[model samples]
Target: MDANSPTSQYASLAAHCASAFALPVARALPEQPAAVTAPWCLTVLAADIETAQLEQLAAFVSADQWRPVALDILAARADCKVVRIQLEGDIAFAAARLALLELGQSLGVELVLQAGETQRAPKLACFDMDSTLIQAEVIDELAKIAGVGDQVAEITLSAMRGELDFQQSFRKRMGLLKGFTEASLAEIAPRIPIMPGAQRLLLALRALGCKSAILSGGFTYFANYLRDNHLAVDFVHANQLEFDGGALTGNVIDPIVDGARKALLLQEIAKALDLSLDQVIAVGDGANDLPMLSLGALGIAFHAKPKVRAEAPQAIDGFGLDAALYLFGLNDRAIAALLDERT
Candidate 1:
């Protein structure tokens, strides 16, 4: 084949892939393109990109057949940047993206890559309630007020870290709160702090015509409260805490919402909305959230544990939930404009 033939162009990309990623060239180039339908975006959060770092990134992109299309400053506060790139020839999309992610990580930068359509806005955004949409874990707060904070918190930690099964953890924790009154839940529910940026993110999603839902391992009482009072969410799916005589029954309703349920709920919601999985986004902060996170088009770990952070496709460690907007290619000015239209 001619060196400059169409096959040669792809061969060049494949050769670069082999040298850069240590992956077989044949495997890198798929028969059909990866499901990246939109232009690729590389978002940098948490800190400014030094001139040297930007140069490095530019050189990396130039090495392949991808061309840098545009650069937008997403946030001035953190000096966040979002670079859009377009492929100039047939290349392995996933492998190239993985290489970019590794490059950003090496620079201590939080990076997120999204399909082009992701910038158009998601159709549905699902969130894990505890430690995600809110500042505290609802069950842990209940346990604290019930005077079993230490024991329940330990179990909660283990479960979040993937050390224990979530169902067993929930049962054990509920048992510890067996005698707590329903009134205690009311008090705690009203006091649970709304996570910073929760309102902003929800409001932005609403303005974009996105339906939001809370798929939580937490109880329905708190999820409903948040949906009604704080977030502009359209749906809620969570485990119901059973009650007897205005006191805790120490048992959750049958068919608890565990990790598997969370993923299934994401699928159901997507289907109900007439949207594809790629049009959905899921955010969480624990091991149980893994399933739902992996199910969505974009899964983000928000201030997550080490294991979750390492495994989640994307993560927000030093920023608020609102930082998620950047992953969808929204800039600070665009978000501010979206918020201002409220009047």
Candidate 2:
């Protein structure tokens, strides 16, 4: 590719982003420009997305006055591949995301973007426990053992959907699990289902020297089990269910790890580690996870509720949690290399 080719420019431009602003006097390119530059990047993930389809969106971008530079291949698999497009002009946030929505859906791809400055892999990542790291909501499982699964699951759904107050809903759900035996609760722990791609994702993150924490609205009982037995997490913070006489008391210890508290803990950890909030990544799938999600530099709604998907900065419902690697610009080879290096 020619040095002046629009397709030949992103790596250097991304490095000099501090000084590279918009081009003045209305710059225009030839019929076929090579690689290019941009401060904002759009990462495309799908089984296969044709260059022509992407170019159509690029043409639309050009028509709308934003410059589309180069399309770089990041990672690939037998089924899906990840690619990125470098953009130059500063388009509105929503517009940049929507640029590929229609075309992306038709092409069967998921597109996510972030400011180039913050695109480096996060040093700290916070995850919500239930329905995130694990497939089961602990309370619902306990409620079922107590013969009140329907009642608890209802409130759980309501709270996750952002309809009911989380603390109140949590207490209600716990109350229903009051009669559950200690033995039953213990049994639930070992059988808890881990989310797909969870262990690999954590191991990869650990290899990258990223600290992972579980900030759960669920009970500490379940969260601790996940931390100790399954994932490579460094910290765990969650609500505690009190037990008396070998039965759940239906009461929790103070300091419920609701949304607000999750946000506070995220900051506290960042400060203690001497890292900026911009270096943190938060991932969750419910309404109560929103606070911490909003705090991190990049918040991902991982197979989340509709409300969360709509509100969060970025969301990926098309793949497992491992798809997050693509968001950090880690292609298949990079992820494989990181996994190989993980202990």
Candidate 3:
């Protein structure tokens, strides 16, 4: 970081922030724009970037033969910033996506690459509960009390990674909770760790006029709790766990919220909200999430398994959930303003 650079203030704010420079976009120039009227957009979200590195990336875009027609500093905070690059050319999505991933890994940042469409700030935000809304898989917590923690965790991991069928794995795991008590389950629900940035993200989305929903393969107990606690959450749907005599019956009621069901619920909610799928943003972290993930205009695999990450149209493991704001075209300043308005 040069002392004279415009970003010197941010450089000082981020201790040990590296000055990153990429080789190039690393793709054969696709071709000149055939009949396109709009420029494609690349939005970079990062903790820090020095002036010279930003210039290098702009040059790299030019090196790929794409004309960088415009650049915008969406945000300029010391701790976080977003840069938007508007380019004119026919760059292949695959090549640009690869470049985006490599850039993120090399520079410790997150990137969103897509056509520069004026997508309405997502009017509907759908989220998966376990590992998405919160850090823990609720069932695994229950299994721990049931003394089957290891067994349930193994199945959960396999099921999440798509190596095992969700319903089959789900039933098998529930069976291990036959003797788990309602009291025990309730005790753990309050302690479930909300994913970092979840509360702020939900509040910010609501402020942006988006209706939030939780479509979970997990049980209703915890899901409903999340909805109740977060005033911004509009609705929630999850598998119903049947209990009797103040204890678990080890069965999920009919109509399990599997992958297919999640997708259905998303459509149902969109219809209820009078919004189309194009105005939606679906986010999750597992194989079961893929079905619903594909439905949204901006479907994201959030800090997901490798298979899920590869399958989703977009993946964001580079930052916390609030980073979704950048993909929605909200700069850090805009996000802060929106969130501050909420409080």
Candidate 4:
């Protein structure tokens, strides 16, 4: 259509929207003459469009000009504002809609064009025990008592990067922890500093009626301590140190729950809870945690290694463990209120 012609209807659409932008908005801009266009759909979004019968407006225009895209409620808004409309069929409609939607969203119109699913309901929170839920590595702590701390820590770092199989790494690390006292487990338990905001974050999840679990590559000794300290951890799966005569046997129990095993535990727990795949949140900072974390609805790299952070969809670097609560759409005030209710 020749928009410059006095009788052309395209002129009216521009004129109608002129007040909104303080400039005429049109399907084709005078400045961009050589832009290649593709067939697309136009979706309208705004409070004004609902009262105006936007569908009727689409019908008034030539079928070749534009087509109705979709109608949606604006994100996180109270009013029944007319949201995005997707247009289909013609390339001109697609180009025009994309431009307008981009512009509208930038103007704070609550417009989301081509956005992916951003939120998921969670029923369980899974954590990697060592260097994740707790700052100290249970194996390394044991190794220190054995006087092999430096040797074991190197292997631990390699295994956490996925370079060595977790089973092999745990076997080698456990050999070093051999002959440590059972009393040492008790000693390390209380000294194990939790990652920042760990307790508060777990408490928040519990208050939300969500279950928590630890699927660790570390030993079960420290895992038990986590549960005893008022953290509502529902499950603890880790390597069992083979002990005989009240001393380490330099072996682990069979069927060690390593990286692959941890992934299985996540699926099992989710199934046992009757929660969908999209209703689980997994957090960890090491290579072993990657498998389950990737499967979770909300996989978070919590102050993670570089590789973990690169693979994770969401990551928390600066904030405390409690900062992850933000992913649930809660602000500081809302979190404080939830914490307040518990007190």
Candidate 5:
């Protein structure tokens, strides 16, 4: 192949080495032209590839299969060759470079190549209102009036950590609020500080025609508060606390909204909106948020507890709730354009 030809360009790219890379080769000479679904095809070779090496190539954490390939020295299998790749985008040159690096670092291995790209879109944004979109937990604050703030907060922490089940844990905490008044909600609702950049993020999604919801394990009182304020959510599914004679009735309404319920609500809302599971993004910071997170297309563990972060595919450790927008590829100018539309 001439150096100026497409095959030559891909061959040159594949020859360049790094820890892991993908190279694109010219399409085969055939009677019919097939569609190039992925921008680049990668030839991966790693007799020994480590987790860190995979992360450096993929820009995300590596799962376990590639570890041994990075660590051991093995003969390149011609007949039983396999490809273990963590794809980024479909840039042929980029993939080629990544694949070359992997091959260069390994002693013996050669795998086939195919090019592809992933298009991720969130149709539904499911959120936990308390401590996720907003900074406060409604029931925890109310516990202070009943003089069980410390105990209630401890249980809240435990429940959020996945140590306790949501309904059971919430009931244990709510029992401490037997004499609390609904009036406290009025005071606390206004004081609930919205998470930084939360409003802008949601507004951006709404502007983009994305459906959103608050599938909270919290109560309807504050869920309504979010709706009445700036959330602009399409649906809200939450627990309802029963009251009597202007005082706490010490009993929750029937069908408590718990973890399993949260998952069901996410599916229900997605179905109602005619969106598939791959179009839903579930964001939360607690253990109870796991079910819905597991079910969505991209489950963001936003400033979540350590356990939640470990299990979630994506996490926002450096930024605010608004950072979640980055996973959607939105930027400052895009957000400003969105903000203007909402007005």
Candidate 6:
């Protein structure tokens, strides 16, 4: 095909995106370029930014040779500021992203860098329910109710930090909850604080016709509760906590949804949805979440631990879940419009 032909043009675009983002060239290219055109995106967030901070950001951008094509405010909240910048020229997206990270650190702000099929949102977004979607860990809460909080919490922390096997720690923790009444779960479920910005994230994803799933090592009851009542997520894959006569049996159903299982479930969901793995996004904050995170085209460590943040391809520690929308190329205005339509 001629260099200017449609095929060649698409190939060139794909090559540029791959080179910029450090993604595999073949995997970076979408099946239909008309539907998904990649673009560079920079999102700046913080609890607050001063005039000095803004001037610093501007100076940094101007000094860089990338030469942004457009700059717009995506959202400006009392505690946060999201900016969308489109760039021109042969830019190294990864290097620019690193520079932004350094800048954000210096300013005590959060900067997120995303470059890929900006026009195409992930078909499915899989989340780790406990810490990522909600503010508490169900197991630890259950342990607290059962008067084994300290013991179970130690194990839970070890498991999450990758010091112990998840399955083993899970069983040990469940053992501590033995004899607790199922009614305790009902009480705790309602009280589990949903993560800030979760509702908005789900709302934006719904508007984009993207399905959501909860792939958690937590119990089915809480996952289903969030999916049905809180987030309206499409699917949930979690371990079933076995109960007898409305009391905890200290056992879970076979085939615990460990890290490996989480990855497999992501693939299964993608296959079932008729989408590629590249069309999936996974978010989590623990060691067990690494498998699923690594499998997705876009994997984020959300408010994660040092280990997870170090390993995950992307990390969103300083911001809330709504920042994930920026990765999909949704600006503040677009999100506001979507929220208005829903209201």
Give the residue spans of candidate 5 off by over 4 A: 1-121, 154-164, 341-343
What's the TM-score of each model vs. the native?
Answer: 0.80, 0.83, 0.83, 0.65, 0.66, 0.80
Per-residue lDDT tens digits for candidate 1, residues 100-148, read 6677778666766655666657889999999999998888777777789
What local lDDT does model 5 show for residue 250?
78
For candidate 1, the lDDT comes to 0.74
Candidate 5 lDDT = 0.60
Spell out the clash pairs found in candidate 2.
5-34, 6-34, 6-35, 6-36, 7-34, 7-35, 8-35
For residues 263-331, what per-residue lDDT tens digits would candidate 2 score against the true structure?
Answer: 999999999999999999999998778888888778888888666876777877777899888777565
For candidate 3, the lDDT comes to 0.74
Question: lDDT per prediction?
Answer: 0.74, 0.74, 0.74, 0.61, 0.60, 0.74
Q: Name the lDDT value of residue 214 in candidate 4.
A: 90
- Model 6: lDDT to the true structure: 0.74
Give each prediction's root-mean-square deviation over alpha carbons.
Answer: 10.7, 7.8, 6.7, 14.3, 12.5, 10.4
lDDT of 3 by residue, 93-148 (tens): 76777676776666666767766663337899999989988998788778887889
Q: What residue pairs clash in candidate 3, if any at all?
A: none
Stretches > 4 Å off in candidate 2: 1-37, 98-103, 157-163, 341-343
Query: Model 4, 22-43: lDDT tens per residue?
Result: 3224342222111112222122
| Sequence-dependent TM-score of model 2 | 0.83
Worst ten-residue run, lDDT, model 6? 27-36
Q: Give candidate 1 misplaced runs (Cα > 4 Å).
A: 1-38, 60-66, 78-102, 157-163, 341-343
Report the lDDT tens digits of candidate 5 across residue range 1-343: 5654534433333333223333332222222212324333233333333334433543321331121211111111222111233234423433443444344335343332322221223678899887888887778777876788899989977865778877778788878888677787677788778888788778877877888888887888888888888787888888887788877787878688877888998998888888888788888887778888788756767777667766665555434676555345333334445567421
lDDT of 4 at 298: 70
